[model samples]
Structures are given as C-alpha cells and as structure tokens.
Target: MKKWKIILLLAGVAVVALQITNPARTNPPVLHDLAATNPPPAEITALLRAACYDCHSHETKWPWYARIAPSSWLVVSDVNEGREHFNFSEWPTDPELVVKRLDRINEVLDYKEMPPKKYTLLHPEARLTEAQRKFIMDWADAAGKKTEATAPPK
Candidate 1:
C-alpha cells in the first residue's frame, strides 16, 4: 500500500509539472538574412543549419521531447551559452571578433564539441561528417590566415 501511494504521488506530480511547464509554448528565434556581411554560401549554410544553428544562431528549432521539463531547461541553457560564445547573427568583420571566431571554430571543430552529442542524438543529420569538418577547417584556415598579420604572436 505504501509503494502504491508513492507511485500515485509521483504520477500526480508528473501531470502537474507538464501542465505548468508547457514547453511547447516556446518559440525559436529568427534567422536574419546576412547577405550584406558576406554570409556563407548555400552549401555551408546548409551544413551550419544542420550542425550549428540549433545552439549557435538566431534560429533554434526545438524538438517535441525537448519541450519536456528537465530536458527543456538543458536545451535552453545550452543555446543560451552557445549564443554567449558567438552569435552568428552579429559576427563582426573586425579583426578582434574574427580572431575569436577563428579560435572558437577550431576549438569546437577539432574537439567535435560544438553540437553536443545530446543534440545529434535526436538530430542525426546534425552529426558532422569528415567532409563537413574539412570544409569548416578550410574556411577557418583562410580566416585565421587573413587575420595573422595583425594578430598577436602565439
């Protein structure tokens, strides 16, 4: 009888929690057209939308289960943290921002840590392939090289 009571209590809490949270009410941010700032080409844009947009851009499409309590908080926090690191919507062409972007790009790409595995679990296509890594690295190399002359020595 005690075990049954505990189960009933837990069930009641779950129902109340879902009704109160209602994560599905949340809406994602909007992605602005950045053509004036030399936005990435279609291929790279597609890749970024798959692998990076969910956390690092103005656009963040949440999944159905992602709307659930603890999971929603985790997803929201990750996106928040990612935006703080670098928001593509507001990337600067200036050397300072460029340098930071270059550095972070390498760090995240090299470590395969940008789009956390937790994200790719539901979004398998978001998983970076070898080709995608090479493309990103190539771009980062070009940016890093461009900023090298004025960049502080290592």
Candidate 2:
C-alpha cells in the first residue's frame, strides 16, 4: 500500500479506538432545582438556563455533537469542571457557601468569563447582551448582600 493509504488507515483506526474511551455524559437527578429552591425572576432564570446550565447544573442538555468521540470527551470534562465550581442543582443552604457562590458568580460575570466563547459561538442564545450582563450583576449583588446579612461575623 502507498504511504498516504497507510496514514489514512492509522487515522481511521485511531478514531475508532477513541470512540471506546469516550466519557459518559449524564444528567443525574437534580437534588435541588435552583428555580424550585430559590427562584430568581423569570428573566434571570431564562438567561441562566440558556447560558450557564449546560455545564453548571444537573440539567445539561447534551447536544448531538456531545455523543461523538473527542468532542464527547471535551464536553464531559467541561461539565464536570463547571459542576465542581458551582452546581445550582446542589445549591448550598449554608449562608457562607451561598455568599461564596454569589461572589464567584459575580466575579465571572464581571470578568466576562462565563458562557465561554466556544459555547456562545455555536449557541448564540447563550450570548449575553450588555443589558443582560447588567441585570445578572444586579441580581448577584442583591443575592450576595442578603447572604452576607445572614452570615455570622467573621
């Protein structure tokens, strides 16, 4: 066989092998839905659902591309990491945890870091306008203040 044919054959085999190692993507039962537990206004809920929930919550709506090999690995990894940082499905009841979460949310929003660029590229609905960003910032401010008020003095 030609050298190019050999290379193509190896690439095909590698792709097949990669499929076997694809990570499982699951939407486990939500212990505490954010909306049900601490309902935000409808607009905020909609924005969060569109932009953040795919990775940060138990309700991830896995796309068809997520079922593919290498892409599957990346999508699963991101969701796992996002949940590690903050999971609305498992909202913290403790005031301190709530404040920490709120602070993290504010930091990410202020830095324009959440709803990563790659995500917004494909899912335009996830793109936040300046107005939406301001709204989220306002909500985070209020939530953080409330949590701080309930927290014991350091």
User: Cα deviation in Å at residue 130, candidate 1?
Assistant: 1.4
Per-residue CA lDDT of candidate 2, range 1-154, in tens? 9999999999999999888888989898998876654568899999999999999999999998788898998899999999988899998877777778778888898999988999999899999998998898899889888778877787
Displacement of residue 96 (Cα, Å) in model 1 is 2.5
Tell me how far the alpha carbon of residue 24 in candidate 2 is from the true structure, in angstroms, after superposition.
0.6
Sliding window of 10 residues with minimal summed lDDT for model 2: 31-40
Which segments of model 1 are wrong by more than 4 Å? Answer: 1-10, 18-35, 146-154
RMSD of candidates 1 onward, in order: 4.4, 2.4
**Which candidate has the top score in lDDT?**
2
Question: Positional deviation of 94 in candidate 2, in angstroms?
Answer: 0.7
lDDT of 1: 0.72
Quick one: RMSD of model 1?
4.4
